[model samples]
Target chain A: MRCPETDNQELLVAYGAGRLGSRETAKLEAHLAECEACRVACAAQATVWKALDGWEAEPLASDFDARLLARIASEEQPGWRRRWREWLRAVAARPAVPAFAALFMVVAGFWLLPRGAPPEPRADAALVREIEIIEATLDDLEMVKELSGGDRGEGARSL
Target chain B: MKTGVQQTVVGVAALEHDAQLMLRVREGDQASFGLLLEKYRAPVVHFLYRMVQNQAVAEELAQEVFLRVYRSRTSYEPAARFTTWLFRIATHLALNWLRDGKHERLQERLDEEGEGQTVRRDVPDRRPSAEQILLKRVRRDEIRAAIAALPAKQRAAVLMHKYQEMDYAQIAGALGCSESAVKSLLFRAYETLRARLRRLA
Candidate 1:
């Protein structure tokens, strides 16, 4: 067999892994007897493989399945609030979404406003009108009191 | 010859069975999902633990992996073996976690808790001496360090190959690489491990 080092190292890997067929294994063993480089490389790999077996993973937590199931359940039943929050999060993640939303709000605000109608009076202007009406009513009351010919002092006091 | 053929048939049938279970899951079969979860939970978690060298993070990542499997059930297609799809999700999440550098932050905590948390499966039924226990712990730590020193992809390849016992084609499928690339990765990874771990052996 050609030296697996320069030829087909995959075979050496397979042999080290114990994955090669018996025929291939026999052929490789025959080659190993004559090849010092292959022997050293294979020995090192075999040692590494054996050492790796010493690191056994700790057993999983007891609640692993329960926790996973709960997560799935929560995801499956995303309440309206959660759904809304998720939707907002998804929208926020995309810059264009917020920009388009702001643009839409501006456009919709203009579109929805009453067209061809007079604008409502400002708060300050309405306040002035209210004050003028109150003063006019008071003047009219005083004039009525005078026309009734009550005592002047009494009329003034009443006004 | 006959046994070899029989084993191949059995393997193919098992793959089909996993796909069938997934198909049922896609069709709103909750029980099938439970079965699938039960089957793969330990392997997935253990693989993550080996990858991250942190048990808590591994379990969390494993949950995310299963959660993804559940989430993607709607669009499930058995284009490949079920294990391949499962590991692909796991490998992606793990790689992302490592890339995000969360492992570095957790490394200190893992070291603090390492002694209390790690179990020794090889311990004899009779109580072993403190020296034996300490020796085993040191050996295990060395092996883990050696594995952790490998590049992410190579580390993943080694974990899947050694612990998961996945063949080259299956690993390539999970890793989304060609078979030859997988071989190259395993080759380099083993080379590094041999150099670091030969003394232990």
Candidate 2:
């Protein structure tokens, strides 16, 4: 008779938990009857399971409910501020949000930062200066025209 | 089996109820929120306590868990069981706490004889002699320590499996892993447990 392989821990765990299919369980059982090592392995796993049965977590204190309620009240007090922080944290924890935010900030900084030494001056101030320069030039032209002749219209007519 | 299908249908109905409770919670029903907290507080605390092996830390984390649930109430989705959602939050916190090395000092503190002394007092004094009581305490401590020694994912797997009585599907949903991954986790976890607790067996 060919002995079945018993080295599969998954099968053993399922067998121990009685979760294995009937055919698999039967085969493991047949192997277990004949194999000392597999049997010992199963027994050890079984013992671990048995020992775990006694391990119950201690009951919460009687005031646990009250304490939790108190916590809920405290959390509700500052409400929106806490909510914002939680939202911020959740958003920050997302892989793409922070990356996108960082990329945006960097692009924004590059776009807004002065490319060279601060702008020569305000554009409005430059415009005002140019207007003053044009006014002065016109005033100079008038003076030249007066210096050239008192009646430029008469001069043009004579020409 | 027909019964299995019936059980699935029942489970879905129960989950719908939980979802409705969450919906009420979203609607600013304080009582509904409190009801949820009351229902899940012990199980969450117990699961965390087992994960961290420190009651204070466990309780603190449990509070954070519920606080998170409340904080996220507005965005609550009824896609899964509330318990599954709750545990996923919890398991994330515990894993982070462990990763931050916060538990290392606590584990050391637990290792000291004095700390174990207090844990022993919590036990009802049933043993006839001090030695038997001491022995039993040590054995229990050993089991806890062995469990804590497993990697965080494996430990979470085993805790959900053994304590929560959650099957592979539930655990996978909670841990956000495949069912096969959960099986591997449990297999490795129990393998370590078997190795560590062999003498006891």
List lDDT for all candidates, in order.
0.87, 0.83
lDDT tens per residue, model 2, B27-52: 99878988888788888999999999
How would you encode candidate 1's per-residue C-alpha lDDT over A89-147 as one tens digit per residue?
78899999989999999999999987887977779988999999999999999999886
Off by over 4 Å in 2: A1-5, A18-31, A78-159, B1-16, B109-128
What tens digits encode model 2's per-residue C-alpha lDDT throughout A1-98?
22245457777777766677989888788878988888888898888887777567876777776776766765666878778766887889999998
**DockQ of all candidates, in order?**
0.53, 0.36
Q: Please name the candidate that would achieve the greatest TM-score relative to the true structure.
A: 1
Q: Give the per-residue Cα lDDT of candidate 2 at A122.
A: 64
Chain B TM-score, one value per candidate, order as shown: 0.86, 0.84
Worst 10 residues of 1 chain B by lDDT: B115-124
